[model samples]
Target: MTVSSGSPLAPKVVRGAFVRLDEIGIGVVPQVIAFQYNPETLTRKLKPYEQPADKQGTPQDPAARAAPYDPEEEMDVAIAFDAMDDLAEPDRHPQTVISGVADRISALEMLMYPPATPSLLTSAVGALAGALGIGGGADPVPTTTEVPIVLFVWGPGRIVPVKITTFSVEEQAFNSALYPIRAKVTVGIRVLTADYFTSKLTEKGARLTAAESIAATAYRAAVEQKKVLAAVGVASTVESVLATLPF
Candidate 1:
């Protein structure tokens, strides 16, 4: 697939908080596959610092517990694409085929990296400067900042902010010259909660907000529940064996 602005199939640019990926702009679009979503739920137990005991030695506050919230959503996906198609036409590009693929993968890694944070040495030096009463005279130090959050837009509702947690690549086949021609990259991405980047996103238009996240999670859970309920009579499992009729 081609993703260049000139390409016919270029991804449509959506307004609002949609984040652009592949900022460096790869010449070819990678075929994405094995996209999977993993939703999670979290809760806090309320058993105060110390439970008061009743006269019988039992706890007094048994009705204070609350139900857990609905699950949250995360996703994982793989992008497979060929590198160094130029190898077929060595006259077109000067670089070797192997180097081309290496370059592409290297760029992918850069995308996942969070901007550099202040180092221990820098903090130590700053402290020393303050102690010496030379802090005002010291040159300002440059600090790293967080990279932009990415938007995983599969379709209308599938769009969500994501943090890339993992990236794995397999070089499947190589040419006689030991140049890699085929490769597959598997990436694990976690969806950001609506609470994530609170200062950045809102629900006015295309941007996903915390309220939207809750609704999306609930929608996914309802769909899953429907599937489970449908299988109660039509599908069989350990539960079915115990309840099956004789013979």
Candidate 2:
């Protein structure tokens, strides 16, 4: 169901959003995106951090083994896009007539790439100064880039930083500029937990700026909330088991 679905008299609805935060937890202006409509379904997968005793390198002494860690989690969902509603307001969204969903698509696609760096001319000027002995020969702008953190917000219960693992967009109808007016975008993300950060548990060659403590408190809060929900399941689980066994 959509986030807005409810009795007409119900309280205000909360929409899901993708919030971009800087290296130190500050919100990035204009990077926030709220969903127009919620996806019909959300698929989540969890893999426990288990170590088998039979494994060759596994710890033999229970006392020497490391403490159990949180499970790895992933979510996959489809996001729909349509320009018809925006196209209705010609004065407000006139670009839709020519560019269709290009702008919307660009916003999501940009998350996968590095932010724009110094312009070629700026670098050229820097190099020229270095050659003329006006400055250190090292025109050292960072050769590596650290990305801003992205948090997936679904109501108050879940607000965790995540890494986008997979993204695919299927464009349907197009405009004269070859931009899709109708599209289905599927995204897969891996939730970053307490143990995840730069020089920690990360994919090779992948670096996120969360090491600077961006929204880290929120991530821990979300983890605690999930544990509370799991604890609440005890009573319902007992009832179901007794009912099935005719106890």
Off by over 4 Å in 2: 1-10, 23-30, 52-67, 116-143, 198-212, 235-247
TM-score of each: 0.42, 0.70
The local distance difference test score of each candidate is 0.49, 0.71
The candidate scoring highest on lDDT is 2
Report clash pairs, candidate 2.
none
Q: Per-residue lDDT for 213 in model 1?
A: 48
lDDT of 2 by residue, 1-247 (tens): 1254567877667877777653211212325667767788989999765556766776566445454777889999788889988888968988888888878777777667654563364466567667776557455334447555688888889988888899999999987778999998888988887666533436766654443365566688998997899888976697777878944
lDDT of 2 at 221: 90
Candidate 1: TM-score? 0.42
> Each candidate: RMSD to true structure?
14.2, 7.7
Residue 205's lDDT within candidate 2 is: 69
Name the top TM-score candidate.
2
What tens-digit string does per-residue lDDT give for candidate 1 at 62-113? 5655434323445455555465556778877556453656555555565576
lDDT of 2 at 157: 91
